[model samples]
Target chain A: MELHDKIRILADAAKYDVSCSSSGSNRENKNGGIGNASFYGICHSWSDDGRCISLLKILFTNVCIYDCSYCVNRCSNDIERALFTPDELADLTINFYRRNYIEGLFLSSAVYKSPDYTMELLIRTVKKLREDYNFNGYIHLKAIPGADINLIRLAGLYADRMSVNIELPSEKSLKLLAPQKTKESIIKPMSFIHSKLLEKSESKKLMRHTDKFVPAGQTTQLIIGATPESDRTILKLSENLYKYYDLKRVYYSAYIPVFNGNNLLGVSSPPLLREHRLYQADWLLRYYNFKADELLTEEELNFDVLLDPKINWAMKNLNLFPVEVNTADYNMLLRVPGIGLRTAKRIVKARKAANLNYDSLKKLGVVLKRAKYFITCNGKYYGGCEIETNKIKNKLLPKSNVLEGQLSIFDSIYKTESNLPILV
Target chain B: MVNYIFDGTFDGLMTVIYVSYYNRQIPNDILSENSYQKNFLGDDIYISTDINKSDKVQNAITTKISKEALKNIYYVYLSELESSYMLIYKYVRLGFKIGRKINYFLQNDIVNDVIKLSQRINHEAYKMIELIRFKEIKKGLFYAKIHPDYNVLPLIVPHFAERFQDQYFVIHDVKRNLSAVYDKKSWIITDIPPEITLITKEEEDFENLWKIYYKSISIEERKNLRLQRQHMPKKYWDMLTEKQ
Candidate 1:
């Protein structure tokens, strides 16, 4: 096949993974290296589907031996397959990186010959990029499940970030949809990467010039709405992944049905709103210091479609409402419905100079429409009505379609308004 | 009332501060020569650029207030807003009064405006770092063109120079008619022609491949042009290869 045809096929197959972040690595350029990684990631372009194209996201090859029903590259599917030579892939990465088309490469693959063989191919490709080309840009590698622990370790040394996708949320879903894969196969490599990352950090404290091993850390993805797992279950699993594995990010890809055959549930469209809510709750868990239980309960299996996860939580716990912004602790400020991390920090810092009134809160970038229902600036309540749950819920609920102005999935996941454009 | 007119350089602005402070005159407004309007009411004083006076003012700001305050002042000056000059004058004067605590006074309109303008410049500079795309012009020479809202060419070139130290590249800010050229050893910002188009056959081939890859990567199931435009605004679309 032609090179362009191969890229089209491989990139299309790889788009479903949805882990395009090029962040969390600070790899410096060597004396003669071609590129360097920034502390925070840079997005090169946004795709037509509103996703940031940060890396050259593509599969080394689309050929697979496993017959996972939900995947487009399943063995049973009669799809065109292409494999890239190690040198060909590395050359493409260098050419693209030089032309500033991408930050680096995000190489994943289906189980082509064997897990170990495929993993070896990935290692050779990155090795060629790093050693032959002296490329020090960001690289995100996918650790093939069931690959040898030693091989995974070697790949981690080359990659800035490595991920092992836990596609299904539960073991039961994995067995039903991807019969060939086992839970142990996925978790073992993740646990191995986690420990290696910890060891790297510990050794770096003792000595400054240790070889970097996955310096950007690891992230995983879970396919949502495919296997009847509720939002509560998905969030709980993510919280555990963060707490136990010390993972940097857990991506939730709303399941898009690739095969319309038996066993897999049929959906007309991707569960994007549910995915958006899950991401919102994920942000609360990661940055806002809210536990999964605090965001949802056993009785509430799914997020309310009308309101965001944070507003929902705030309405439920009305006793915490009307907290004085002037005197509220930083943690309490974060818990307010409309107060984001940047605004909360700004309030904390600004209040040290003088008391902040409602007008000043607006200038600090607080979303007053929602925060008024929860916070009081200087002992004066601005929430016109009483702090009743239903009244606040009615005010906060979306007047239009909830999905009309929804944020792009990746952009809204983090509270950093670093990407927001300034209006001239 | 006196209106201070400067030569539109950071040094000139600093000299304006120096002259105004030594003369003990509170100007009605501070304007760059390019943006100054003749008003019959206020006396307009054209302040020439003086390195010695500017250095003293800069040193005083660094010693009395903070280095961060000086950075904020520079960024606000780069913003080129008509009010930015006066805003910085008030901000620096206030910074001298409260030491480093001036930045924390977000409620004060002058300090708040200065911070916001500086943040805007920083934001645009960061965006340029992300959105600038280079095309291989000749075998080893790469070129990119951008028209950012703020004068962010100087702010963003250091990043590219560091990342592509061994390669030859030019980043042109078309709106300002300036280009930063790096020739494998060092980089310099200089004037460029208003129109320059240089492309190679190989560059076109790679651009086509990138356009193809960009299209293939977007999920058809979730296509939100609004969100795409929100993140990557339409004003920047002309320079983006894939968008074109």
Candidate 2:
């Protein structure tokens, strides 16, 4: 097949794996290297779906041996299959980087022939890019499940980041949809990468400036709404992954329906809002020191689509609010509905110099509309009239369809002072 | 009311600040040369670009306040806002009076304005870094043209230089008629002709692939053009290969 045809087929197949970030790694270009990774990722363009096109996210091939029901390129699907030669893929990446079309390559593949075979092809392409082409850019290689540990280790040295998709939330869901992929196959690589990363850090302590091993760390993706997994279950699983595997990110891809009548997966497509709320809750967990149980419970299986996860938590725990803005510590300030990581830090720094008022807080980047109800300035409350939960909820929730304006799907990127979203 | 005129350069603005500080007089307005308007009743003072005076003022700011404060001042100056000259003058005056603690006085209109102006400039520079797409022209030279709201050429050049160390590239600020050229080893800022066209025969194939990838990646069920425009604004569509 022609190169353009191959790119279209492979890239289209890989688009479902929505991990389009090229950040969090600080890989500099060597003397004769062609590119470098930006600590804060750069967005080359926005897709029509309003998603960032950061890395040149494409699969090495779309031919699969495993028949995962939720996937587009499953074995049963009679889709056109195409693969890129190692040299061809490397040359394309260099040309694309030279034209400033992408940050780097995000190469994944279906289980074509076998897991080890697919992984070997991926390792060959990346090695060619890194060693032969002298490309020092950010590469996020998806580690093939059930692939050899040695193969993964060698691939990790060249790639900045690696991921293994925990496609479904639960073991039951995995068995029901993807029989070929066991929970063990997915978790084993994650555990191995975690240990290797720990070993790398320990060696670095012994000898300063040690060798690299997945310097950006490992990330995983869970297909939300494909199975009957609650938000609580997903968050709990994600928390454990963060604690145990030291994963950089747990990407939640809103399950988009490829096959209309697939009885295995009931839902046509997961509401993008649900995926968005999970991302918000994910951010709160990572940055705001919030636990998964605090965000949701088995009773409250899903997040409120109308309100953000943080604001919902704030509404439930109103007693914590009316915290003194001037006296509140950084963590407490962060709990406020509108106060993000950057704004909270700014308030802390700005308050050291002078006593802060509502206006000063606004100047420091706090969203007064939401924060005012939760905070007090100099023993004065600007939140106004009878601090009732219903009133506050009404104020916080939009009077009209708030999602129309607010539901940008990628609001986490634009709204949070942090440029890179939680997915990165 | 007295109006002070400057040469529209950062050094000239600093010289104006120096003159105002030494003379102990607050001008009603400080205007860049192109922005200065003659008024029959108001007194006018045209400050020349004195490098020594500007250097002294720069040193004073660096020594007394902080390097961060100086950076903020420079960012605010690059904004070229309608009231930037006077606003920066007031901010500098306040800084000199309060020493290093002027940033804490967010209640002061001048201090708040300066901070906000610098934030705006920084936001623009960040956008420029993300949205500036280089097109490969003839002889493997990558050329990117940007018309940023703020003068962010100096701010974004360092990022490109470090990233594209092995490749020849030019990031041209078309609105300002200035170009930053990087030739693998080093880079220099120089003036360029307004209508320079450089395109390779094979560039179209790469652009087509990018556009194809962009279109294929978007999930049609969740199409939101409004949100896309918020980050990758419509003003930058012409320069983007995928958009083309």
Candidate 3:
């Protein structure tokens, strides 16, 4: 295939990986680098999926040797095959960067004849971008499982971040849906990168002076609703990964059934709402300082469809309500229903100025519709007279019909935020 | 009545506001950049460019409104809205009467109008962090020239400083002949030299990668330029890396 043709195929193949953050790296341009990466910042664009296109995510090649039943670019699937030489991909990356089209490259690939060859192409493309093209911008490369350990390590040096898709939650699901892949092949490289990050972290002064390994760290995606694992199981796996692997992100992709596997659990799309709820829960885990047990039990396959993860937690723990925002510790403030990180920080800042009043609390953009049930204003309860959990559920239900009527067949979808109804 | 005219800067606005607050009978009109002779058929007029007097006026208003409040009024003036020039005068006058409770003006429509203009400038400044992709030029100087919808040159420095810590760079807002320069240690608001031409950007190494990434990530099945244009209008494209 021509270079452009290869770019087309590989890029389309790699679109399914959605980890796009390029912030929190201290990489800089030097004698011959083409771009630099920054901390606390990342460039973003919108995909057709409305997903933020922060990185120029693509693949080095889409021609695979292994047949993963869930993937569209699997070897068994009859699709156009292509591959790009490292130099060609590098040149394209530089061109795009110059035009301000993207922050950096997100290079991934199918097996492409062999696992080692695919890893080599991915590594070479990043090296050409770093050494030959002098590009210093962010580059996120996918570590191909079953590739040589040395190759994965080299790839890490050239890329700012890396990800290996866990794809499914359990070994049984993997065996049933993708017989060619194994649990060890995926986890082994991830464990290696995690330890390497730790080693680099230990020699922090030297790594600080020199360019570090994957300053944006690593991420991985899990396909939701593809296996029978409950939300509890998924959250437990995520908790372990965070505790052990120190993964930067764990993306949940809803299964969109383009093809059927004999062992696939669902035929229709995994509820996108379920995916959204998972993100909310993930946010609670990462930012709101909540545990998986606080939000869900082993029996529940999903969170309450009507409420957000934080609000649901607040509903479950009504005893924690009417907590004084003025005296609440940072973690407790973080758990308040209407308060987000920004609001929490703002409260901390505003409280130092003077004792915040109920009026002032509302002015800080606190969503009283839900927060009233969780907080007291000037030591006075405003959640409601009874404040029953079931009553609060009906009262606290946000206006869901926001974009539902807004997305009529003839209406413009982009003009609205959502297609669901808000039943307050 | 004497005119307290000063150079076109925040100091100049401050001087005028300070002088106007001390008295209520001074009828004045402003002439800036281009002055044309009009038929002064029925009215008597006084022309003044007393920069020192303007400075005196600014000092007094700073005392009356507090330095922070006065500084905010000056930022509103920089927004360059025609009403902004008058709004600053009225709000400052109101501030002098209201004392330290000048924040009440934030609710008044006239004050809110100027706030909107200031918000536009601030928004442009924020977008600069996201949209202003830099290209390294000769001598390790990183530069990016932007043509933004609002004059946001003054507000982008702090964000870039926190983000790109060790780098030295210049963000030029071509529309207003203004730029922000950060030299690793500190940032300064300055202007581009008149002798130098604005550098024309070409398809550099990173641009190729970015364009390919853009084309590759855009699924042909779900290409929606209308939605894209709605979120990011074409006018904002010149400064945008991908659109450019």
* Model 1's DockQ score: 0.64
For model 1, what is the error of residue A269's alpha carbon versus the real structure, in angstroms, after optimal superposition?
1.8
Model 3 DockQ reads 0.21
The worst-scoring run of ten residues by lDDT in candidate 1 chain A lies at: A415-424
Compared with the true structure, the alpha-carbon lDDT of candidate 1 equals 0.86
Model 2 scores a C-alpha lDDT of 0.82
User: Candidate 3 chain A — worst ten consecutive residues by lDDT sum?
Assistant: A410-419
Clashing pairs counted in every model: 0, 0, 45
Task: For residues B208-230, write the lDDT of model 2, one tens digit per residue.
Answer: 87777878878776676666777
Ranking by TM-score: 1, 2, 3
Off by over 4 Å in 2: A398-424, B37-40, B194-198
lDDT of 1 by residue, A173-260 (tens): 9999888999999999999999988888898899979998999999999898888999999999999999999999999887887565
Write model 3 residue lDDT over A76-107, tens digit each, in one string. 78888877788877777665555345678888
lDDT scores in order: 0.86, 0.82, 0.68
Identify the candidate with maximal DockQ: 1
Q: Between candidates 1 and 3, name the one with more favorable DockQ.
A: 1
User: Could you give the fnat of all candidates in order?
Assistant: 0.75, 0.68, 0.20
RMSD of model 3 against the true structure: 7.1
